[model samples]
Target: MTPNTARRNEASRRAVLTAAFDLLQEVDYAKLSIEGIAARAGVGKQTIYRWWPSKGAVLFDAFLMLSEGAGGEPPMLPDTGDLEADLVLVLRATVDELNDPRFEPPMRALSTEIAHDPELAAAYAERLDGPLREAKRQRLRSAQQAGQLAQGLDLEVAVDMIWGPVLNRWLQRTGPLTTEYTDLVVTTALNGLRPRGSSS
Candidate 1:
């Protein structure tokens, strides 16, 4: 397609996604529908179905777009060669994004659905979770190579150490997810949450 056509298509797609995002805030996942999305988007119902197989798919992509700079599909992590600083930088940004109203509603809905639906969970794993996990894992691997991460660290668990608390506070809304809290998570996870050299 020509550049103009490509741009127009992108704009139209974004409009559809934006409409879906807005609708998701007002309705639960089970109630969300492609017909409803197309109505909200000012497009034909077939337009939505032609592009996405399910409402979940549409919302997942919408969330991905909204969360782009907020630790989801970020162009790059804060790689200053200082692992703690880098991690704190990214995690702090993530906390701020999670706190934002734009990312909160759809995120809450999608996560809630994932708990009860195995099929949606698997689809989420393939499309959403895998990429995000891989991104975190890549950053951790970089830290290890830089000699900042612990040698022979279980990369998966190490990733959880960094990701868990931030997500916990963000999703559960149980505690403050301040920059200070993120900084502490960075320091604790990297240097061990216990006394120096003591197993956590």
Candidate 2:
């Protein structure tokens, strides 16, 4: 495509994603329609259909676009040589995002899709979860190297142990997702995850 044509296409794509995200904020998921999105975006419905197969796909891209901002990457977990402090920082940020009204509906929608839609679930695994989970595992590896965590600990389980509580609480709505709760959770998890002493 020509440079002008490419720029126009990029603009339209961003506009469509923005419109879908904004509509999800204002309307029920069931009420969101391609026609409405196209109208809001000032693009033809065919333009949306040409690029995406279904409303779910558009919603997925919109969620990704917003979550990634302009970077085309998920935000990285910080590693400051202090695993507990780093995890607490990451978890507290997660709490903030979960508590945000702007992120809630789309996150809810994506969670539903992840539970039932195999294709979207795989896409999420490959595109979003995979990178993020790897980052967590890498940080855990650093802690192990530093003698801060168990030498033979299973990274996956370690990851779950560190993060599972808050995610469970958020999804089940069993408790408040507060910074205080995340702080306590991080401290408690670190206590359990500390390097076990060698036995005779």
Best by lDDT: 2
Winner by TM-score? 2
TM-score of each: 0.76, 0.86
What digit string (tens of lDDT, one per residue) describes model 1 on residues 1-200?
Answer: 99998998788789899998898678876788888888888888887888887777787778667656376433556667777777878987888877787767888877876777788888788866887788788888988898777788999999898889888877788898899999988888877745784543
Local error of candidate 1 at residue 143 (angstroms) = 2.2
User: 140 in model 2: Cα distance from truth in Å?
Assistant: 0.8
* lDDT scores in order: 0.80, 0.86
The regions of model 2 sitting more than 4 angstroms off are: 67-75, 193-200
- Each model's Cα RMSD: 4.2, 3.1
Cand. 2 Cα-lDDT: 0.86
Report the poorest 10 consecutive residues by lDDT, candidate 1: 69-78
lDDT of 2 at 17: 90
- The pairs that clash in candidate 2 are none
RMSD of 2: 3.1
TM-score, model 2 to reference: 0.86
